[model samples]
Target: MLKSWRRRCRRKTGGMPELTIPSHFLCPISLHLMKDPVTLSTGTTYDRHSIETWIEAGNRTCPVTSQVLRDLEPIPNHAIRKNIQEWCVENGSRGIERIPTPRIPITSTEVSEMLVRVSEASDESRCREFVAKIKQSAKESDRNKRCFVANGSTKVLSAAFAAFSNADETVTVLAEILSAMITLTPVLDEETSSNLSSEHPLQKLVWFLRFGSLSARRNAVLALRSILSFDQFKFEIVVKIEGMVEALIRLINEPICPTTTKASLLSIYYLLKPTENSKGIAITLTEMGLVEKLLEMAVDSDRSVCEKALGVLDRMCSHGEVRERARGNALMIPLLVKKVLRVSGMATEFSVSILLKIVRGDEGEEERAAAAVEALQAGAFQKLLLVLQIGSDEVSKEKVTELLKVMNGYRNRIECVDSLDFKHLRRPF
Candidate 1:
């Protein structure tokens, strides 16, 4: 009957028949055909994507009814879906295609239940299995991630990590749990921060940095960065942990991967970033030989790594001891000069800040003059001029002017320029 009706309609129009779709088949939100129809608590049906997007935008009221969604869960309108599919099959020649069955979304209840299983597992193997399952579900789609976040997976995983005693199997399970928790960091609440900052979980994260798999190490650094960002007071306690700074420095010194290397650099920056409460962190990091590692990273061709390395170096160079250490490295002055105006604005700012610190050292006038001479030989004099000409932030501009004055005072006093300075002078002409 549908075919004969289509034939008659086509014969009248002399082309494909125009089938009028039922109003009920359209989503109330999108006003398009409901491929995967789901009924909201307000008894209005919308396409799954439409409603999910609506709710994700923080809307609690249904679009059609404007009624409060007491239960945010959307029930699948299976009968309407089946009808839509049948209609498409019947109108196959009318440029309509059947909708495929939608995958059942993981619910918050399921996520909560999974977390419960993860917390209640009896042994390492079972715990590992449940944690892996959670990781898999979280990786499946964005909806599942929202479900995990809504279900408080971050707190549960952090608690699980703290519960484990030190063992190879336990470390393995803890690493997996940490990896899973890393995905749930869309927002870090106070409770989650408290849980992660506690002794056991913090130690486990540090352990992962030193001994976990490559992915685990990367996840650990990212997790630490988030925790530190969420709570700044933890810095004082975190730096005191044994081997915490060393492990991060190792990752920087012997990079596992670009991601892990950058993450470690960022984590270190969070620690050594100049805060009134964090005054000693820079000293501690430099004493652990972080200055040499940062100098090595500053020269990396990857501008991101170079920028972060310079940012940390700038922060550390605020200290007289760190400045002395940096100036001691033959490559440090030249690296800072090369980065100015060459990498990025942030990079140039950090590079200029470090150079300014170098030339303005607190040791003595003799030490400052010697550092100024080194800057001149490193081609910093010309780069400072370019920064002024090319236009930079007011702070960098001022620092560039000061750096040029200091280097100029020493430039006339020095007789020899390094090959780098000679090269720079010839290239621009």
Candidate 2:
């Protein structure tokens, strides 16, 4: 159907004579043939879509006239519309066809009123209807979304979400709308951010992670990420939620999809970064068995997931409790060894950093030797050699050398750290 329309509009002559669109028929806003021409209060005529868009963006002046518009209503210029229609039919021999009547745009006032009605909705089914309509409007066009934002849809959505007294059935619908708010507006206002934070929206978001559908859960995660980016205080508040950390850990352990997996990992990773852990956030992560899950994720086939997983692993492993946690998990040593050259260079760096912390003996010499013996048994030497020949930067090289030197002292316990390999390993130092 689309191809036929394009073919009909082309000129048929061999020289391909230019299709001259009438100057008066063009919309000043888009410079295309006007379909539903409308006259503004300033007496300038524009295509309905173009002028409606201009007005919805908070502009009250005409695009062509620049006169301050007196009223919001745009009067339809039916005479110009009929004339354009006649010109299109007259040019139908050149494949041009009459334009179909355009659908009237949903008014900004209508959007604002709908949002107010949604916020004031009393029950689950009613909220669902409003959510569907708002999501449809947002999905219609970026223009509609900007208009919605201009009328303060984000605050209304957050307020409706925060004021929901019954969370059991409304969680899914509320989260769906909140996620739409995220997708529509690139950034949330500080007042909205403050509202969500004070109202503890993170608790509900964490709930959606476990109870909502895939789309609901995905959007919930995205919404959480946006709030967490607000500032350090919001991050601190979210981490303080009773089960928020565990929920992120659970998502990482049982991923619904790679995109959500990355989002969950990012939220957890940010929480573990250099905050005052007197509250034991990292310790809680370790206690909840995050280290083992991270080790598994570090070897993921997706390079980006693997890099982020390794990044979190590196941060967690640097903590005393988390370091001890990784050392105890038998799979951690070999996976770290295997991931060295298996993923991206960033993953390799993080993997090596974990081993260095273990092998360097902050936990004392016994822990260091135990780590060395474990790595040797896991074929750490085999993989380390591959990394050294390929991706290892100077810092990684030095760390590998230090690990091997530590392992060299424990060579008698391990079979793989043999005499011949030592010759190649020592040459680089």
Candidate 2: deviation at residue 126, Å? 5.6
For residues 310-365, what per-residue lDDT tens digits would candidate 2 score against the true structure? 88887777776677778888788888888776667888788888888888757878
Task: Give the range of the ten consecutive residues with the poorest summed lDDT in model 2.
Answer: 1-10
| Residues 71-175 of candidate 1: C-alpha lDDT, one tens digit per residue | 988999999999999998987766577888887889877888899998898687888899898888878778888888888888887777777744445777787
Candidates in order, TM-scores: namely 0.72, 0.63
Residue 137 of candidate 1: its Cα lDDT?
A: 80
The local lDDT score (0 to 100) that residue 208 gets in candidate 2 is 77
What lDDT does candidate 1 reach at residue 269? 78
Query: How much lDDT does each candidate structure score?
Result: 0.80, 0.75
How many steric overlaps are in each model, in order?
0, 1
